[model samples]
Target: MTATAHETVRDAGRALGIPDPVTEAFVRLLRPCVYPCLYEQLPEESRKHAGPAARAGGSAHLPVDVVVPAYVPHLVTVDCAAIPTDVLDIDFPADGHVAILAEITDQDAGFAIHVPAGTETVERRPRETEPDALKPCASFPL
Candidate 1:
């Protein structure tokens, strides 16, 4: 079976004698490679701007499978809350693009849907910018 990104990197770390923290940092930096779908699925309004960073209250952490076309697939966790107003005003796009976390069979493959199965439609809410708003929203059991 194909290894998870963490396992793949960890194996490389062991072979190269890289520290755990360094390997982890590398993984984090490379994590966004899977999110190209985010840009593609962005509301037309948000596509023209740079993607926003994860921030408190405005971001929801969901285990998503982002598949940028023609790239290696990713099964990384991402925060979908609090898109910057300057970037995009919406958080999770109501557009059906997120994939079902449980039904995701190919962790290393791209998902086709915008929203996956088993997710409730979240109510539209205003952004939360408080520093303390950085708590975990809903976490997928997967």
Candidate 2:
């Protein structure tokens, strides 16, 4: 059974008992790999550039880990109202273990890069800059 991008990530995550924060990172990673399909499903104006290369083998490609870029704003945002504060408020021992908090803040603080499964890090890069999108593909802004 093939999993849609959203389903693939969700299933793998749930089965392994991945936490909510990690799951959000997975979704961000998935957007780049699957956004082209999403665009095709949208109207033409909504659909702009696709991606750098056609995905190999037509099977799914997903990124496992995302890193927090330096000095960037908003890696992810938490909707405090949505989740049960009782659970999200889970506490850590206060013996100077603040770095973990900082790391979480950093990863959730700015944009992220997602390298697809089976691909090397060097292959992933920022798409070209465009007025319509966050970063456009390399074509001199059409």
Clash count per candidate: 16, 8
Candidate lDDT scores, in order, read 0.41, 0.34
lDDT per residue for candidate 1 within 1-142, as digits (tens), equals: 1247569888999799999999878776552232334445567986676454322222222324432232222233333333222333244553323432222346544433344434554422223544322233442221
Q: What TM-score does prediction 1 earn?
A: 0.23
**How close to the true structure is residue 12 of candidate 2, measured as C-alpha lDDT?**
81
Summed over model 1, clashes come to 16
Pairs of residues clashing in candidate 2: 73-109, 74-109, 74-110, 75-108, 75-109, 75-110, 76-108, 128-136
TM-score (all chains, Cα) for each model: 0.23, 0.21
Q: Candidate 2's error at 114, in angstroms?
A: 24
Best by TM-score: 1
lDDT (10s digit) by residue, model 2, range 1-142: 1247667877788889998679868676542311223234566775464332222211112233444332332222122222223422243222211111112343454232333234433222333452322321232110
In model 2, the runs with Cα more than 4 Å from the true position are 1-3, 31-142
